[model samples]
Target: MNEITSHQCNLNIWAHLPDKVWNRVANIYELMPGWIGYIDGIPHWFGQEEDDVYIQASVEPSGLSFYAQMNQSDWDSWIGAFKLEATKVLGFEVGEPEDGFE
Candidate 1:
């Protein structure tokens, strides 16, 4: 969707992590390249950055959160790639995170 357009769908990707992993989660995003500064103060990854879709990511206590506005197919590909990367960087299985879209 265009930046100016209101998001019709909301997507959330969340996972509970270990205590140690919690502290490092924020750094992962910080060190990663190609992300929009913020969308209303939320760290964001523009669709243009990877695939024509927008994604927002943040870290919570023992959890990782990702918000986005995009179609199912795009979300699947995007999140799938994220899991793989997280597994490599975090050194864990990085199993499928819980997801919701509407």
Candidate 2:
């Protein structure tokens, strides 16, 4: 997809992330049966089942990860503010990784 950025560096960026936003997404949370995976060497804190799944907002430009397929109702409950809180904690904003460097 045009949104997902490729992590060309050689490091696990998610591992270095603070437990502020996507640690669960980095270590757990299943998007689908065999659709989740751990990605290495890049920004965005997520893994995927494969390179073909176009899940939204699953990866972060900061190399942290998130889930795009949470229960819709559950996600609706706090996903927005949760993002705000998490971003506030990180002193950064979450967006598609196309504007600049990590």
Model 1 residue runs over 4 Å out of place are: 1-34, 39-41, 47-53, 97-102
The residue-by-residue lDDT of candidate 1 on 36-98, one tens digit each, is: 566566677665434556777655533455666666666666666666666677776665334
- lDDT for every model? 0.55, 0.39
Best by TM-score: 1
**Candidate whose lDDT is highest:** 1
Clashes (N, CA, C under 3 Å) per candidate: 1, 8
Per-residue CA lDDT of model 2 for 1-102, tens digit only, reads: 234333221112344566644554433233223333434533222234354322333333455444443334433433444445444544566432444424
**Residue pairs with clashing backbones, model 1:** 47-53
